[model samples]
Target: MSTPVGGDETQAPQSRFAGITAALRYPDIRTLFISTFANQFGQGTSHVIIGWLVLDMTGSALLVGAAFAVRSAPNLIVGLAAGPITDRYDRRILMKIAVIGLMLTALTLSGLVYFDVITISILLCGVFFLGAFQAMYMTARQAYVYDIVGANRAISGLALIGLAQRISQLIGALLAGTTILHIGGSGPFLAMAIGYLIGLTCIFMLVEVGDSAPDRQETIVENLINYFKALRSNRLLLSLMISTAGAEILGFSHAVILPILALQVLDVGPEGLGLLTASRFVGATVGIAGLAIAGDVKRPGALLLTTMFFFGISQIVLGYAQTFWVAVTLVAIVNIMATMSDVLHQSLLQLSVSNEQRGRAMGSWIIGIGTAPIGQSEVGLLAGATDSKTALLINGASLAILALIMAALLPKLRKL
Candidate 1:
C-alpha cells in the first residue's frame, strides 16, 4: 500500500488504499469488514426511512425524538450486562447470534408493515428489541476486531470498518430515500432484513482466526465481579470512558433537535433531511481517509480536543444556517470533525487498555456511546419548550465547554 504524504513508512498508506489492502491482508478482518459494511448500509438506509416514517405518522418532532430515544433506551438498561456476557462466549458466536436476533426482529417488523398494521407504537416496540440486540452485537464486534488483527493493527482495522460504514451510509441514505419515495417504508424494512440475513450468511462462512482458546470457566457473577474490579483499578480507562460518554451524549443528543431544525429553522423537507444526513457521511468519509493516510499521528489527545472543538462549532453553525444548502455544509463539517474525534477516541482507548480486558473495556466504552438518547430526551424537552435552533445552540455550547475541560484535564490527549 502506498503511504500518504508526511506519514512514516508504515503509516503512509492512503486511507482508501490502506483500508482495501488491510482487508485483503487479513481474511478474518476482510470477512468482518464486508459483513459490517453490508449491515451498516442497510442500517443507514433504515434510519432515514424510519425517521421519515415517524415524522409522516405524527408530524411531531417530539415523536421523532421519542423514536430515537426508544432506540437508545435499551443500551442504557442492558449495556452493562453485555460486557460480561461477551467475555464468557466466543465473540464470533455471540456476533452470529446477535445478527440472527436482529434479522428476526426485522422480519417481525416487516410482517407488521406488510400487513398494514404498523403504527408508531408498534414501531417503537420493534425499535426497542432491535436496539437491545444491537448493543450486544456491537460489544462483540469491537472485541472481535482485536482478536482478528491484534492490538498493533487494531486501529487500522477500525479505520477500515469506519470507511466502509461511511461509504455505505452515503449510498444507503440516497437509496433508502429513493426507495421509500417509490415503494413506501416496507421496502426499506424488507431490504434491511435481507441485508442482515446476508450478514449472517457471511459470518457462517467465516473461519474464526485468532484466540480460539476455550473461554475460562467462570460463573457469570464471577466474571462480572472481576470486570468491576478491573475497572476500578484502571483510572485512565475510567477517565477515557467518561470522556467518551460525554462526547457521545453531546453528539447524539442533536438528533432530537435536528428534525425540528430542518422543518422549522431551515424549512427543508425529507429530501433535504436526507441530504443533510448524507453530507455527514461525506465529511466522515473524507475524515476517515485523511486519518488512514496520516496513520497513527502523535498527540491523539490534542487531535481529539481540536476535533471536538470543531464539532461544537459546526453544530452552532448548523443551528444558525438559514438555507438548506448552508445547513448541509455545516453538517458535513460537523461530521468531518466527529469522524476524526471518533477514530482518535477509539485508538486512544484501544492503546490504553490491556488485551485480556479489551472486550469488557470496549463494552464499557459503548455504554457511553449508546446512552446518548437519554441526553437527547433532555434536549428534546428543551426544544419542546423553546425553538430548535436555540436548543441546538445550547447543546453546542455545552459540548464546547466539555471539550475545553477535557482538554485541560487530560494533557496527554492534548498532545494527540
Candidate 2:
C-alpha cells in the first residue's frame, strides 16, 4: 500500500545539523564571523597578558584590578552613545575604523613592551582606547548582523557569531599561557596585535548588505534624549532592560568573589583556581553550542527567564559547595545558564526593536553589562562584611526572587 502523500518523510532529519550552517551560507556573514573570531581571540589573549603584565609590574592586586578596570571603564561612557552612532552611520565603516583603532592601540602597546618602555600610565591609556573602540564595534556589529540576515535568521546568525567568539576565546587563552612562558610578555601582545590585523582584513572584505540609518541632525544631547524617550515608550524593551541589568548586578556580579572563595573557603590553591576559572569558560562554549544546535526556540523569552532562574539556583548551590570539584561543577552550571540567557536575551532584544532604533536598544542592553564594575564593587563590599559564601548565597537568592517578580510584572516579556 502507498503511504500517505505528506507522510512519506523518509529523508534524513534536518535537526542533526542545526548549528552555524544556515548562517554560513551568506558570504558576508562568513567574513564577518571570521572577523569577530579574530577580534575575540585577540581579546582573550590580551586579557591574560594584561593581568599578568600588571602583576609583574606592580606586584599588587589593587593595581592589577585597576589595570583591568581601565579596559572596562569606557563601556559605561561609550555604551549610551554607541547605539545612536551605530544607527546613524554605515556599520561597515564604523567597524573598520574601530578595528583600525584597536589595531593601532594594540601595536602601540606591543611597541612599548618591545622597547622596554611600558609604563602603567601608558598601558592604561592604551587599554582605554581599546575599550572605546570595542564599544563602538560591538554596537555596530550587532546591528549589522540584523541588517545582513534580517530577523528571520538573526537568532542563528548571532548564535553563530557567539560560538565563533567563544571557541576563539578558548584557543587564545590556551595560547596566551604558553606564549608568555616561552617568549615573555611581549609574545602575547604581539600575537594579539596580529589577531587585530587579521580582523581588520576580514572587515575590509565584508560588503555592507543592510540599509544604513539615515543621519539624524540632532545634537549628541538631543540624540541621547531621543534614545531614552524611545526606551520609555516600549514596555517590553524597558522590562528587558531592567531584567537584564538586574541579572548582571545580582547574578553575574557574584563572580567577583570566586578568587576569594577558591583561596579561603575551598582551599583549592592556585592550580585549582585555574581549573575553576577554566571550567566556566568551557561551560560557556558548551552552552552556546547547545543553543546553536537548537537553532530557533519557539519561546525565547521563556527560555531566557528559565536560564536566569536556574542561574540563580546554581549560584546558591555554588555558595555552599565545599569541595573543589563541587565548586567547579556548580560554576560550570552557572555559566551554562548565564550564557544561554545572554544568547537568548540578545536575540530577543534584536528582534524587539526597529533597525533605526536597534543600536540604541543594544546600547541600553550594554549598560546592563557595563554594570559589571558596579556589581563587582557591590559584591566585594558584601563579601567583606559577611564571608564570601554568605554574600554569594544572598546574591543568588536575590536574583531568583527578583527574576520571578519581573516575570510576574512584565507580561509582555513572558509572551516573547
Candidate 3:
C-alpha cells in the first residue's frame, strides 16, 4: 500500500489524514482552497452563460462549437509553456496575476455587453483569453500544492480540492440558470468578475512560500524537447496519459451535446439541462467525499481502470435514455466514475513522478487533458450532422473498447 513518499509505516495512515486536515486548516491552504472554489464556481456559471449567449446570438450549433473551441484551444497551444513558467516564478504571485487577468477579461466582456457592442467574435476572443489565463493559473496552483501539504499528502489534498470543486459546480450551475433568467447574461459576467477579484484578494493575503528550485535551466525550446524526451521514455506515464486522454475524449466530447440532448432527446428545457448538470456535480461531490474518507488506499491504479470502464458504460446508458430523469441519473453515475478516475490518475501521477520533473510531468498531463476538446469539437460536428444521442453512443462505445485495449496492453497500469 505504501510507496515511501514521506511518513513512517506505523503512523502513515493517521499522518496522511492529519496532514490533509492540517493543510485544510492552514491559512495558506484555506485561502488557496477558497479562492479556487470561488474561481471554479464562476467557471461553472460561465459555461452555461457562454453557450446560451452564443446560441442566442448566432442560433447556430456551429458557432457554439466554435465558441467552445475558442475556450479550449489555448490548452492545446499554450499548455506546455505554462509548466515552465509556473516552475520559474513564485506560484502564488503567478496565481494572483492570473486572477487579475481573469478579472479584467471578465470586466471587459461585461462592459461590451453593457454597451451593446459585444459580437460573437469578441466573445470568443474573450473566452480564449480567459482560458489562457486559467491554464497558467492551474499549472502554477497544482505545483504549489506540494509546498503546502508536502508530496506525501498530495493525493489527500487533491481529493479535498476535488470535493470543493464538485460542491461549487453543484451550486453554481443551478444558480447560473436562475441568475441568467432574472438578471440576464451581463449579470453573470459581472458576478464572475467580482469572483475573480475576490479570489485575487484571497491569494494576496496568503503567507508566501519561497519558490522551489527551478527544475533545470534550459532554453524554452530545450525544456520542451526534454519534456517530450521524458514523456517518450516513460512508457507507464505515456500509457496512463493515453488511457486518460481516451476516456476524456469520450466523456467530455458530450459537453456541448448535453444542451442539445436536453432540448432534443429529453424534450425538457434549460431547467432540465441545469438539473442534469447539477446531478453530475452531485455525484462527483459524493465520489470525492468517499475518497477523502478512505484515507490512503493502495489500489489507485486498478481503481482508475475500473472507474473508466464504468464511466464508459454510464455514457452508453445515458445515450440510450428516453426520458429526462433517466438521463439525469445516468449522467450522475457517469460523473461518479469520471471523478474517481481523475482523482486516482492524478494521485498516481503525483506518486510516481520525481520531484524535479513534476512541472513537466504535470504539463504533459495537461496536454492529455487539454486535447479532449478536440474530441469535443469533433463530437459537436457529428451531433450537428446527426443526433446528439447517436454521437454519444458512438463515442461511449469507442471509450469502452479503448479501456479494454489499455487493460490488455498495460498490466502495470493495474497496480499503482
* Residue range 160-187, candidate 3, lDDT tens digits: 7778777887877777777777777787
| TM-score quality measure for candidate 2 | 0.85
Which runs of model 2 end up more than 4 angstroms from their true locations?
Answer: 1-13, 50-69, 111-125, 211-225, 258-275, 321-326, 383-387
In angstroms, the error of model 1 at 125 is 0.9
TM-score of each: 0.90, 0.85, 0.90
Deviation of model 1 at 188, angstroms = 1.0
Global local distance difference test of model 2: 0.73
User: After superposing candidate 3, which stretches have Cα over 4 Å from the reference?
Assistant: 1-22, 208-222
Clashes of each: 12, 1, 0
lDDT of 2 by residue, 1-416 (tens): 11112322233337645435666666777888899889877766765676667656775444544655567677777788787777766778989888888888888888888889999899878878987888778878877876766666677777788878777776776677677667777777788778888988999997654533333435556667888887788777777777777787777775556556655577754444445655666677889888877776778887888789988888888888878888888888888888788777777776777656777777877766666566656676676677777777888888898878877987777777
Compared with the true structure, all predictions reach lDDT values of 0.73, 0.73, 0.73
Candidate 1 Cα deviation (angstroms), residue 225: 1.5
